[model samples]
Target: MHLPKNAHVALVDGENFVVMRNGGAPLEPKLDRSEKPDLSASNYSAGVKHQDDAGQALGRTDLEELAHGAAAAAWLNAKAVAGEIDDILVIADPKTLGEMRRHYHTELEKRLVGEIAKTLTGEPTKRIEQIIADA
Candidate 1:
């Protein structure tokens, strides 16, 4: 991927969110971790906990996972609205990516540079750099 200089890269998963900036040449990008937005303050709530018909407890973990995606989308939308983001690439687990897509703001969508649907939250920074370079 030919990320522009200083382009933002967001790596996210159900439980992790990271932001990095390309600080080197676009082709040989060097990623530096940037301070991420505090998503904990967002009013992202897990969906209904119980089945409406069966009255059985639905999977709490699943609902929490959905909230994670909502939080990410909300943060990104805020950045876009504030003109804080120039260009951005999103790297996320497939499920989270799908969830985020459903909530993407038009402004955010306009600034999107690319997206890779794979979980890389646990990968080392060097590995991530390599992956982005290869993309």
Candidate 2:
């Protein structure tokens, strides 16, 4: 849980994604909001359907949620491929995290430092830093 200085921390959910950078010591991370990139156009599940083993409709697919996850993954892939990130910690909701995992790029995998399966997108920066430190 020791976030190196200048490491990137990404907090994401189905609808929200926030990136922050550690601006303090590794043991006492001071996360500062970096940027909020617009990712509303990466929907890859527009016409996808979900079905059970019996071929019955499982439920309606959450298109917005799917889009957000896909968008976040694409963004991370781009950053990784471009060598824009040295280290990154991903903190996301369980479902979104799974979606992202399905689309992670090899480059992104290499830059990933850690992952926490929790929804911290709406949490304040201080709270996130504390949670990561405690973890």
Looking at model 2, report the run of 10 residues with the lowest lDDT sum. 47-56
CA deviation > 4 Å runs, candidate 1: 41-61
* Per-residue lDDT of 96 in model 2: 82
Candidate with top TM-score is 2
Q: Which stretches of candidate 2 lie over 4 Å from their true place?
A: 45-61
Clashes of each: 1, 0
Tell me the tens digit of each residue's lDDT in model 1 across 30-60. 9999976667634345344322444324533
Q: How does each model score on lDDT?
A: 0.83, 0.84
Task: Score every model by TM-score.
Answer: 0.85, 0.87
lDDT of 2: 0.84
User: Whose lDDT is greatest here?
Assistant: 2
Q: State candidate 2's TM-score.
A: 0.87
Q: Please write out the lDDT profile of model 2 over residues 1-135, one tens digit for every residue.
A: 988899998888888988999999898999999988888756666325432343325433565786688799899899999999988999999878978888899999998989999988888778898999998
